[model samples]
Target: MSKPIIATTSLAGCFGCHMAILDIDARILQLIDLVEFNKSPIDDIKTFTKECDIGIIEGGCCNSENIHVLKEFRKHCKILISLGECAIMGGLPALRNGIPVKECLEEAYLNGPTVGRNTERILPNDEELPMILDKVYPCHEIVKIDYYLPGCPPKADLIWAAVVALVTGDELNIPYELVKFD
Candidate 1:
């Protein structure tokens, strides 16, 4: 039998979740033996080359592009897993949920001290840029997420164990300490 295909993506996040996947150390070799990676930063695959058995999403959707990519994952993968707190509940980015979008844009573009010399007070309106959402939305809110692994960055042990179990049809050993929110 062939190994499963796994794809991963990080949307409105710090990439901490993806880093945790790599923190599995030597177990990563086992992962390589058990699955083929597709459309993941792990291999820098920019597009989905083929259908995948598993899709691991690491962050919430904060823009149009995130939604597009996430929907594409839902279309291409047999199973979709939300891999961290951000993907499950929007996390830190959701702090701006109640704040007005205009305020946030002003703070970043016009009023920010780092961006001095704003002679024209230009706010980014490029067609090439993905439009920011009024508020960050969790992955499940945007699409049908089949599973959630909740953590600020989910411990490497938890990720390794979960993926191994999913691939091999074994039971999960998710201890209380492994499913942290912070």
Candidate 2:
């Protein structure tokens, strides 16, 4: 039988969730034996080459490009898992949710303490750049997320348990400690 395929991506959050996946350490070898990676940064695959069994998203939607990628994942994968606090609840990036995008952009590109060198006072207007969203949004707000693994970056054990359960058709068994943040 063919192995289940998994894809993953990072959007607006820190890449910490991806790093947490690596925290599983040697068990990653077991994980590799159980599934195939597609369209994942881990394998350096930039686009989906085939339909995937699972899609793991690590961050929130903060720009048009993020929305496009999330939608593509929804289209190509049968199950979508939000794999960290950012994916589940918009995390640190959503701190800007109360602020206007224009003010944020101005502070970042024209008036913040670090912008002294922006003599042209230009804001990024290139068409190639992804349009910024009004605010960061959790993955579920934008797509039909099938599951959520919540944490600043979910515990490695929780990630491993969830992936194994899904791939193996076993019930997920997460310990209370694994789910606890404080």
Candidate 3:
């Protein structure tokens, strides 16, 4: 029998989720034996070449491009998972919800102490830059997410459990210690 195909992406996040995936240690070998990866940073695959059985997304949407990619992920995968607190509720990025985009930009680019020596005071108006949304949006708010793994970076075992359950048709048992918020 062929292995299930998995795809993953990180958006508007710290990339800690991906690191956690690696934290499963040697068990990753077991994962490799169970499934294949596509369009994920792990494989350096930039585009979807085939339909995927599962898609794991980390982080929330904070710009037009993130939304676009997320929608595409939903269309291409049979089971889409919101793999972190960011994907579940916009996480730390959602802290910007109450703050206006204009103010955020000024704080990040023009006025913040760390932005020093910005005599030009430009706020990245290039055409290549994506348009920032007024507020970060959780993945479920934008598309139909089939599952959610709530964590700042979701413990490695939690991720492993979720993936194994889906691929092997087993019920998932999330340990109490692994289910955390903050």
Candidate 4:
């Protein structure tokens, strides 16, 4: 029998989640031997192919690229795991939900004291930048999320539990160390 294919992808996030996965260290080595890593930065992956056994997506939908990735992940992975607080509830970036997108962009780029202040030159309607969603939402809102493990970057043990469950087809006993945050 062939080993299950496991793929990991990132969206609008700091990539801290990806780094955290590596924090699993030696356990990941075991995982590498057990499953094929179809998509992950560590493997120089850039896209998702069809029919992945387990897909781990870290980050939230914040742009067109993110949306495209999410939809593709939904279409491809049999079991999708939302890896962190960002994918579960849009983290720090979602804090801007109450503010206008234009104002937020200004605070980031235009209105900064160090940046040039030229409203006439400022273009809020850039074609490349996706319009911000009216409110932050978890992955399930856009597409069905089979499982979720929440944390700023979820406790590594939780990630390991989820991976084991997916690979072994068993219910994971949520360890106290893993669910303490909830």
Candidate 5:
């Protein structure tokens, strides 16, 4: 029988969750026998595969591209998982939501020690740029999320458990040990 198709995508994140996915390591070979990666590390960008049984989305939606990718994933995948804290809770980048969008952009392009000077001449919010949402929203808020795995970057075990449960058609019961911060 053919293995299930799994598609993973990263939004505006550091790609740490994708790295953690590899943490499955030796077991990944076994997983390879049981799963086909349709998107992710090897495939930088892809139209969502209709054959995808599981879609893992890392990072939060901070830009139009991220939102577009997410909606496409939802339309294609049977089960969509919000992977890692960024997807689940907005992550570190979401902290910027507290600051004015202009201020944040200025910090990066107009006021930062190095790049600030040149940005003054740069056009402020234009048609080319996506508008920032008034507040950061978790994946579920934008689209229905089938499952969420939380953690700055979820542990390999969590990813493994989520997938194993998914492949076997079992419910994922996250243990307390995995969630306890201390």
Candidate 6:
């Protein structure tokens, strides 16, 4: 039988979740034996070449490009798993939820301490730029997420367990120690 195909992407948050996948370490050899990857940053595939069995998403939607990629994942994958706190609840990026987008932009480009001397004070307005959303949104808020692994970056064992269970049709057995969000 052909191995299940998996795909993954990072949207708005740090790539910590992808790092956690690598943290699976030596067991990644086992993972390779169990499944094949498609349209993933791990393989540097920019677009889906075929349908995938599972799609693991690592971050939340913070801009138009993120939404587009997520919607494409939903269309191409049979099961979609939100792989970290960022994918499940918008994580640190959602801290801007309470602030107005204009204020955020001004602070980032025109007034904040990091801003360089901008005599013209130009905000990025190139049509090529992906339009930023007013607030970061969890994956579930935008797409029909089939499962979620919640943590700043979910434990490597937890990720392993979930992937194995889905691939083998076994019930997920997460250890108590792996349940901590931190």
- Clash pairs (backbone) in predicted model 4: none
Q: Judged by lDDT relative to the true structure, which candidate is superior, 4 or 5?
A: 5
Model 5, 85-177: lDDT tens per residue?
Answer: 888888888998878877877677766777745734573568877766666667888888998887767888888988999898898798876
Task: Name the best candidate (by lDDT).
Answer: 6
Return the number of clashes found in candidate 4. Answer: 0
Give the residue spans of candidate 1 off by over 4 A: none
lDDT of 3 by residue, 1-182 (tens): 88899999998888999999999999988999999999999999999998999999999999999999999899999999998899999998899899999999999999888888889889889999999999999999999999998887899988999899999899988879997875
Off by over 4 Å in 6: none
Ranked candidates (TM-score, high to low): 6, 2, 1, 3, 4, 5
Task: Sort every candidate by lDDT, greatest first.
Answer: 6, 2, 1, 3, 5, 4
Model 1 lDDT-worst window of ten:
109-118
lDDT of 2 by residue, 1-182 (tens): 99999999999979999999999999999999999999998999999999999999999999999999999999999999998888998999999999999999999999898787888889999999999999999999998999999887789999999999999999987888898441
Q: Tell me the tens digit of each residue's lDDT in model 6 across 60-95.
A: 999999999999999999999999988998989999
What would the TM-scores of all predictions be?
A: 0.97, 0.97, 0.96, 0.88, 0.87, 0.98
Off by over 4 Å in 3: none
Candidate scoring better on lDDT of 2 and 5: 2
Tens-place lDDT digits, model 4, residues 1-182 = 88898888887778888887887878987887778888778798777654798888888887767888888888888988998888888877788778877777778777677767676756567687776666656677799999888876777777787788789889889867676333
- Runs off by more than 4 Å, candidate 5: 116-120, 123-132, 171-173, 180-182
The predicted structure with the larger TM-score, 3 or 6, is 6
After superposition on all CA atoms, what RMSD does each candidate show versus the true structure?
A: 0.9, 1.0, 1.1, 2.2, 2.4, 0.7
- Candidate that beats the other on TM-score, 3 or 5, i.e. the better one: 3
For residues 69-173, could you state the per-residue lDDT of candidate 1 as single tens digits? 999999999999999999999989988899999998998889877878878998999999999998999999989999889898999999988888898899987
Clashing pairs in 3: none
lDDT of each: 0.93, 0.94, 0.92, 0.79, 0.80, 0.94
